[model samples]
Target chain A: MTHTSSSGTVRKGGTAKRNGRGLTGLLLVSAPVALLGWLIIYPIFNAVARTLFTAGDEGLHFSLDTYQRFFTDGYALNNLWLTLWVTAVCAACLMAICLPLALYLRFAKSRVAAVVQGLALFPMFVPSVILAYALIRTIGPNGGVDLVLNAVGLPKINSPYLTPWGPVIGLVWDNIPLTTLMLVAGLGGVSDNAVEAARDAGARRFALLRYIILPQIGNAMLVVLSFTVLGIFSAFTLPYVLGPASPEMMGPFMQRTFSQLSDSRMAVTQAVITFAICACFGAFYVRSIAKNREARR
Target chain B: MTAHLSRRGLLRAAAASSITLAMPRIAFAADGFVNVYTGSDSNISDFWTNVILPGFHETHADAKVRVVDAGDGAGLRAIADRAMAALGTDNDPQVDLLEAFVPDETEGSIEAGLWVNFTEAGLAGLDMVNPAARQTDFDLPYRGSQVLLAYDATRVSAEEAPKTWDELTAWIHANPGQFIYNRPDKGGSGGNFVRRAIHEANGRDPRKFTLDNYSEAYAAETLPGAWDILKGLAPSLYEGGAYSSGNTQSIQLLSQGVVTMTPVWSDQVLQALSMGVLPETTGLVQLQDLALCGGFSRITVPTNARNLDVAMQLVTYVLSKEVQSKIITELGGFPGVSWDHVDPALRAKYADVIPATIPTFPAGDWDAAINDGWYRNVAPGIARS
Candidate 1:
């Protein structure tokens, strides 16, 4: 009977230890989970809720008026179209620029590659506002570019920095550091042995890039694409300072609705629309991450 | 309990007494300080800190002033949103005073009952305020600015500058890519220019449009002409009619000699002159027979202000002749008071630029409608051309 009591006590002690660990684990995670809900998730849910319902003469009521207004307005529709085009173009440009740069930095055994890599990442340190003003000074009419052109007896160029191209160029410049970094990390995951084997088997540069490197960095490209799309879609300062006033980007349009027009409901609705569009890319990002994790498992 | 206190209990009592003693100092610190949320630039803040605060402290020895830079119009809107959110809640509105540009910017907040009625509140300096400066019973105007054409004198002589709306259009046609104005939606100066053109296009009296009520019928009638006029000039604007995005951008274009002339705020031109953004030869001119939109910056005590009395005191101090003169001399802002009340020297200094007769902004809704119309009809039409 004493031996039975001792064994039972041991089991009880074990259960208590497990319970304690479970409680500790819950406590550890609960704070961060609650914080995340409070900061990010709650605000998003609130914005969506606010967009769905609006206050009226009677009280809170279900309304699609804000969304209706956003869609019906031709200028707002143009803004959305412009935003999507700019974001897509910027994403394509970023990939074209950063992908090759990343691969070169990874494979090349030279100081020039290192210096080029460092210079490519330099924009990360410059603030968007500073970069915008610097761009203005560098490429604005009769600016540095004009001065150089004039010195060489060429006609001064009208600033493309003030047009749609301005925001595209600015967004690409600002995003290169992040995209290059991600691609570099992704290129690291591509095995050098595989490349050597491909080369030995008479694979040309283009063929090696197409079959080996591209497939290896697919996940990284998706990540870069998702973030670049999202960033450019919601970009404010760069576009506001660089782009035109009318047919504005979504970021400035939503800002104008909220602040200048004092139409919070409409602004929230615009935000919801932007989120819905971005969610398509975000879903792809989630699936890619999950696939990456599953493949690792 | 005190009579029968143990050593621990006595020590606790002593510590509580010390804290109790320090409470008044903390309360005094809180009460003596007035928090002002202003959309004014660093120049205004510097003046407030160096001149206004010192002047106020001399009179009221215990008073302390804290100026919060709430940024430009967009920043002020964020503050307004916060203030609106905290309304009727248990939350203490940490803001006391709000500084805003007249008409459109401040109108929404006033309509929402955020600002206290100055007449009801019986604020000081009400009698001293100029009739022209008073936007409404509630809005207490502090400093004034008018929209005018700022030109690079080196590029265009004073005689060569356009004196009327028709002449301005003619000049633009004569000198394509030599003049620019920002999009009307972005800045008050640009908006004023657009409003003036709208008024001119319809051949209506400026005073009729400046009324307190906005008529949709009037706007609908006037806007077509306005769009036509804007489109007509589009071919001659900077870069074959691509406008700069904002007032400052237009100024930058003018200063860089990219464009010879642009509409800019009177005070901004002066400020830019001092900053060397514009050359010494830069000149400002008001259109002949066409009144530019002139309005004042207003100071209001918020309804839920923590320091209402102190805010009122500051407002009164700001409106004083000495302070107004300092505003003119130091900050290059026109006084809230009438010209006669201003110091002769300061008035003479700005006489050439400051128009004697300036048109007030139309009702808030009308101003907003004009901006929307410009963006929708004029901007797009310009783009197409």
Candidate 2:
């Protein structure tokens, strides 16, 4: 009877300890949740609420008016279209340039890979404004590029870097290194044994690349693509400094509207549209990752 | 099949997500000194901060002014809005005074109730200021500035340089891809260039710029001519369709021999010359009829000014000839008031840099064409090859 009573006491004590541990776990998670609510949740709520409700004089109301202006305004539409074209062109170009570099890094000797890898990332460390100024000095009209082009019997190059192309070059310069790094990490995950297996089966190199290698790194490509899209879409520094005053990009437009017009609502509206576009690209990324995981399984 | 189905399902699902980000406000709240928000250049800001402020403080020992370089007029408007909102009250008014460039921006500020009426406080002193400077009701006269042509001597001689709009266009046609200027909508000087070009083409009275007189219909009829002229010369621009979007870039282009000549602010050209950024051979000339002219800046005491008496004293000192001379001689801008009475030494030192006479708007009509988006309509013309 005493033994039974002692066992019951131990069981009750064990249950109490487990309950205490559960309470402590809840307390730990509460901190992050509170922080996120304060930092993330509060601002978004405020921005949306403020933009939606705020009204100004002279036919400027909080309703769909700002969005209306965005669609109808020739400047805004042209810029948006321009931004889309630039971002698309940049992504395709980055993929073309970075994929090869990433492949080479993956296949080359480790020492060579490390050196090239460091050089590739060198562009990333330089600020966009600094890089822009340097580019203008080098490739701008009468810049070094022109001098060299002339010396080589080539026609003197005009400052193509001044037009919309200037920002595009800077964006690519800043983004290619990062994309290359991400792609290298992705390509590295491809198993050598799998590559060898395909080779042993008499698969042509092209066929193996198209099938085995591509599928293995498909998720990584998606991730890199998404990052490139975001980088181009949200980039302000490069475009702000180097971009043509008539920047077609949403980033510069939003900045101009906020800074020049002092139109907060329109700035937020453009921000929303830009974020939406970037988010769609992000979704593609997430979907690719999920597909890769399923394929592996 | 199961994997494919799961993948398709995942793609079909749309989930919502939110992210929040905050940008830090720039420097705020200094002690002893009043925080001034101005759109003036760095050299002038330095002059105002170092010499003028201290000189003023000499009389009123307790008074100190801290100058915050708040960018251009449009940029200053944005700063004023942000600073005021962050302070959560206009009662304290984050900036004591705003020195702006564009009249429209100043008009916007007045509409926003950010400005105090100066018609009552300093009318007598302002009368002593040049008629050109006192004309703008929104601002006190700081100085009158204008765009001038700067040319590379190696590429183009003084005789080869176009003295007028028609001559310039002809010269550009004769020498294709040898001329450049900033995009009009982007740079202040570019706008001046376009406006000047239009006014010169029309040969119409420029002083009548109000919309009632300079109607949209009139703009539609005449602006196209200006656009056509600019577009005709566009092929002569560097890269055909690409032009530098700013004065610095245009000057840089001139330095590189990308273009033989470009339009720039007269003072900017002078400052660049002083800094040895441009070759000694570069020449500056004011265009005929002057398309753009700098206006006077004013210091108004906001109705809600914290230190009203102190603000008046500051304004009173800023308007004095001694302060104006310091502003002009050191800052490289013409004085808001006539420096006819300035000491011979001071005038002699500033003679080369300062214009003997600064131009002004004939009346309210000067910016009428711009109000109708005349500059912007013609801007793309200069961009087309």
Candidate 3:
């Protein structure tokens, strides 16, 4: 009976220690929660409220007029759609390029690897506007490309640098380095032991990669993918400097609507739309992580 | 322990209360700096602050002029839209004096109610501006330029230079591939040249077209004429007919000897000449007479200007003879106020690169030149031929 009582006492002591640790964790996390609430949640709430409810002659009214205007306005819808497609293309292209580089960096060990990695990141170091300007001069008609092309007997192609593709190319150029860096870090977390085990089980190289390597790093891979999506989605400066007047991407469209048309309400509405999409993508990303974790378990 | 707890609570409350009280003052003081939006280059902005604002400050000592460079002409309009939105509230505006394209004054500002009408501002010496400037009520014509042909004298001789439009067209055809100009819709200089061709085709007067009387059908006819010329000239142009987007690109084309000549603003040529981007032997020339040319940029006070008197004074000073001369000589702009004897130093400095000056076709004729079978009917036809 005395031994049983001692065991009960030990259990009680363990419960008390856990409760103390929980309290400390709560205090630590509260600071971040407060910061996020102030910077992100509060401003978003204010921007939405300012857009939806304008003080008018008839008193305050909640309305969907701004959203309606954004959709029905021919240019607005066109630009919004264009922004969506272009961003998707950019994100996809960046992922395509980065994933391979990341995988190679994870597996390979060569002096050239570091050099290639450094060069990939160089575009990100240059300011987006400056990069756009440099690209225009290098590839543009009056720029060096034309000078070289002329010598090669090619007709001077007017700067292909003006197309929507121009901005996309720039986006990919910049994002490749960063995305690759993040992805390389993520891929490194993948277990070599898993791949070796699968190969020992008589799996082929591709099958081992598909089954073992991908699963081990699925969580980290999701994180990289979400970041790639978000980075391409909200990119503004490169597109703003290099893009044509009528690109249908979200960043330039929102900027043009706000700065070109004096449409604050509409701009806010567009920003809301972007935030909503990002939030949705974020939710999906979280679901992906959870799904992968559950599958692994 | 009880005393310590109470003292700590008191100190926290005191700090919070002080911060709350100080917040509004900080916010208020942040709005004290006035924002001026200008579409001019960084060099121009520096000139304004360095040369012009100091003169104003000597008189009003307390006022400070803060100039924000907003790209070039198109960018100015975009910035105006942004600043207006930011300053939509009645409390304070984000911008005061606007240095923007003259077209936006008529096309956008009046409709948006963003501009301050200077009629009742009691601005002294307002009437002293030239008559051509006074015609456009919203436009305070600060400077102007003509779109003309820029050619490399080293590549093509004066004897080979086409003097008239017909001769130029024939020469371009015979040469089979030598002309270069940017897309007319994109570049002002190219658009000017296209319009000039339209005027020549229709034989229309230049000074009469206005909002009062505009004929879209006439423009439709005249514009296609220019397009046709472009189609024909396409083969002869630098590429199979692709074009650059702006003056800078066109100038680059000329510099590279890609095309013997391309349409350019006189100021652009002068700027390029000053920058040593263009060879010393390069020169610019206007079409003989009655070409489409009424280029000007304007500055106006926003409706929400806090210091109207000071802003008005700043505008007056910018348009003053001393300032205009400085801008013309040093900044590579043409003087808008009057064409007086230039400084000898300036004359010597710019002797090799003096732009040929030409009078705009009279305003009435200008209308006829643009609207009545000028740009639409004539330009496209010339391009095809």
**Of the pair 1 and 2, which is ahead by DockQ?**
1
Give the alpha carbon lDDT tens digit for every residue of B10-59 in model 1: 88989899999999766753464687777765666777788999999889
Clashes of each: 0, 10, 41
Interface RMSD for each of the candidates: 10.5, 10.5, 12.0
Give the alpha carbon lDDT tens digit for every residue of A138-192 in model 2.
8776788888888989987656575778788888889978899899899889998
Name the runs in model 1 displaced over 4 angstroms: A1-26, A54-63, B1-33, B40-51, B54-62, B74-90, B101-124, B348-354, B382-385
Question: Given the true complex, what DockQ would model 2 score?
Answer: 0.20
What DockQ does each candidate score versus the true complex, computed on alpha carbons?
Answer: 0.25, 0.20, 0.13
Q: TM-score of predicted model 2?
A: 0.78
Tell me, what's the RMSD of every candidate?
Answer: 7.6, 9.2, 8.3
Please identify which of the two predictions, 1 or 3, would achieve the higher DockQ against the true structure. Answer: 1
TM-score of each: 0.87, 0.78, 0.69
Q: Cα lDDT of model 3 overall?
A: 0.66
> Model 2 chain A — which ten-residue stretch has the worst lDDT?
A1-10
A109-153: candidate 1 lDDT, tens digit per residue = 999998998899899999999988888888987779998999999
| lDDT per residue as tens, model 3, A85-194 | 77788888887787778888887789988888778778777988788778777875557888788799987765555456777888888778778887887787778887
**How do the candidates score on chain B by TM-score?**
0.82, 0.76, 0.74
State the local distance difference test value for candidate 2.
0.68
True contacts kept of 1: 0.37
